[model samples]
Target: MKYEKAQEILPQDLINKIQEFMDGGYLYIPKAETNKRSWGDSTGIKKELNNRNNNIYKDFESGMKVDELSNKYYLVENSIRRILREHKKSNK
Candidate 1:
């Protein structure tokens, strides 16, 4: 989000009221609760990571070691382990 001048957007009375509480600081106006999007939902990052984790599990099942998967995916060993564990739990 970009900063818009209060004078340009807010009514004079509203600006004055805001200034009374905060002299010249930034004010954040959040999006409505109904309009909120979860992290990565709009960017498709969640989908990408899901695909990646699925591939990782496939490779693990096909006899690829955790360390090898980590190196191939450029993730840490612990992250690979967590992914495998989560996949196992999901399968169960």
Candidate 2:
């Protein structure tokens, strides 16, 4: 986001109509609902996290201990357990 002056974009008549309700304060307009993107859609972090969780679940299935996974991923034991649980739930 960038702040754009109304005069630069909106027509004078439209600005006047808007001014009737608001004197000079800034107004925010949001993007259309259908055009909105979910968090991490642009950065690919969501995908990366999903892949990592999948690997963790697979490792656990292959006899890897929760403590070992916690150390390998630098996460708390509870977080590793939670990720495993989430994977199991999603598979169903």
The lDDT of model 2 is: 0.95
Model 1 C-alpha lDDT versus the unseen true structure:
0.96
What TM-score, over all chains together, does every model reach? 0.85, 0.89
Give residue 47's error in model 2 in angstroms. 0.7
Per residue, candidate 2 scores C-alpha lDDT tens digits across 51-81 of 8999999899999999999999999999999
C-alpha root-mean-square deviation, candidate 2: 1.2
User: What residue pairs clash in candidate 1, if any at all?
Assistant: none
Candidate 1 per-residue lDDT over residues 8-53, each given as its tens digit: 9889999999889999999899999999999999999999999999
Best by TM-score: 2
